[model samples]
Target: MEPARLGSHLVVHLNRLKENFEALKKRYKENNILFMVKADGYGHGIIEIVKYAFNDLGVREFGVATLGEAITLRRHLSSLPFEIYVFSDLQFFQPELSELYLEYRLIPVISHNDDLDVVLNNPKFSNLPLCLKFNTGMNRLGLSLEKSEEIIKSLKAVNRCKIFHLMSHLANASMPMSTNKRNIGQKEKFKELKEQFISAGIELERTSLANSGALEQESCKEETHIRPGLMLFGATSMAPQHVDKSWWQGKIISELKTKVLNVFDVSKGDPLGYGSTPCPQAGTVAIIALGYGDGISTRFMGATLYHKGVAGKVCARVCMDMTYVLFPKGTDIKRGENFWIWDGDSKMFMELARETKTLPYELVIQLTTRVPRIYQID
Candidate 1:
């Protein structure tokens, strides 16, 4: 069946995801891969990414930022042999959440000592498998070194629920310069915990400590499992200082395209709409129906968009639902022609990030529900 048309009309390239996973798998063949699909797979559509990652890439484990996200993913995937881990540490929803976890066979990350307490006492987690998250230096979630060792001892005395993997998150993996310090520190911390797990008789069968940034860092590959999020989406913050063009070898997995709504010529003296912003030199102006509300940054007002091999500068103030661009003199532009806002062929997103002073992660998330996303197969 042909997929239904999207209301907002954005396209997600599935082939790029498959290629990225293939590349990563080739690079780290020894490690188990847990595809991180949190934040809607970093705003790339979780279900679609999951399908490609699992069906095409052979990924059997997934990571989510919240219990809600895990539940949603489970509902969409019926009986796939996948391990769904919730990265969040919240335990308040234990009752309802535990029921769902049991129902869907989801793996919950136990962060604090209180987490085990809540689970052991909760009726739903009586016999379910739980993944313990150890916080080496993040100081965010997971049990501390001292606390974790103590909990490991306590679990030996009780009906130790099934344990999936011993895991920790890397804070400095993305910054290649900090790899020595941050990676070393985390390795030492996890090493201590690994010993404790052995002493406590927990096999620590499946272990993971790497995110996207750690994939490139040799020190992070120490763990048997690697959880990658950004790299699988073909977006990387691993930009070198000199900006090597070869670094962008991976294909862009997401592209935002919009059609020109109207085109007209404006004189140099004429002030453009809103804020009475100064108009460009006498030239053709094209209005596009994509704006901040649709994820285009307001700082992109002066940013450039390429259409039919010609570049146009976004002019005037960008409204909530629309923006205007001025094409060079005599440059023919027609209505209904597609405009490339951000695509594989251009550095529009990189420019937008610089102009808005925002990270690529933020820029993508801002693309709210107003813009529809269509998943395209390779």
Candidate 2:
């Protein structure tokens, strides 16, 4: 392996990503993979994944969360013919966003009636492709089924705005057997909305609503296109206990390792980090470069680290840019030695989530964008 990069260098396993894409294609052969490249491909480096999927893996469409994200991706793949769509609500960025949609040939997911006007009224965008987003029940984004119908009628009157796709989001497809009525209601409403759109003469080039949750459910795969996020990174879908099996199936996509900046010997009674947390027995302590500022949450305080196949527990509260771990007496550790924080053999992220009482998605996204992403073929 190469020298460990400081801060966070998410090591994406391109091989595993390819395999996951294949599995999804096999499972939903009729649907297209709108591989979610949002949040910089969920902090795994969007540019690398986009290129791999389009050039080698046969994926033709990508989804982003913001207009800026879409713009950044377009810069990277200037000549790729793949279609790019922004999955976020269209209301936030009006004329400017609408203009970008027209210029880049990008599709904006419209969730509100006013959103349609932004595109239709903009002289520069009156003739671009648009994706109508129906809210079925997620309620986070997308227009209600009734409002969506009206928007369709309005769009039909104009010979401009080309309709590319009709889309919706799933609220609880991850819990395939959930007895939650909300999930049931959302599914029914989304299905009905799709049928209504077709009956209203609002023909979409493609109809899609399956997200990661929907892809996990047999019923959700009926859609013609599905957008998958965490699943592509091999994270467990809503169920933490099911993680071990997922790990084996997908290679560790993000490997966060930091270099040891210093090493010191401390007495058993010596006070450690903020608030004077006690040092672990009398032993040598090694400090690693990474902390909350770099996106390593404070919950990582008591998390474990792997050095040369041996496990060591963090001995103090994590600082804004560093953390210390106690090594057993006379253990071999050096200033430049690498420490694995969250990688193939370590469950630091899972452990940290347990300490903070949170989920993997929160932990994953909390990792800031400042951290450098290093991509490699394995």
Q: In order, what lDDT does every prediction score?
A: 0.74, 0.72
Q: Write the per-residue lDDT of candidate 2 for residues 157-272, one digit (tens) a residue.
A: 77633467878887765565245577778877877877776777766677787676556554466677888887677655645543322322433466676788999999987998
Q: Weakest 10 consecutive residues, lDDT, candidate 2?
A: 242-251
Cα lDDT over the full model 1 = 0.74
Which predicted model would earn the best lDDT? 1
Candidate 2 — which residues are off by over 4 angstroms?
1-8, 89-97, 121-126, 159-162, 241-248, 264-269, 280-284, 327-334, 345-349, 356-358, 362-364, 368-370
Q: What shift in Å separates residue 317 of candidate 2 from its native position after superposition?
A: 2.2
TM-scores for every predicted model: 0.88, 0.86
Q: Ten residues in a row with the worst lDDT in model 1?
A: 240-249
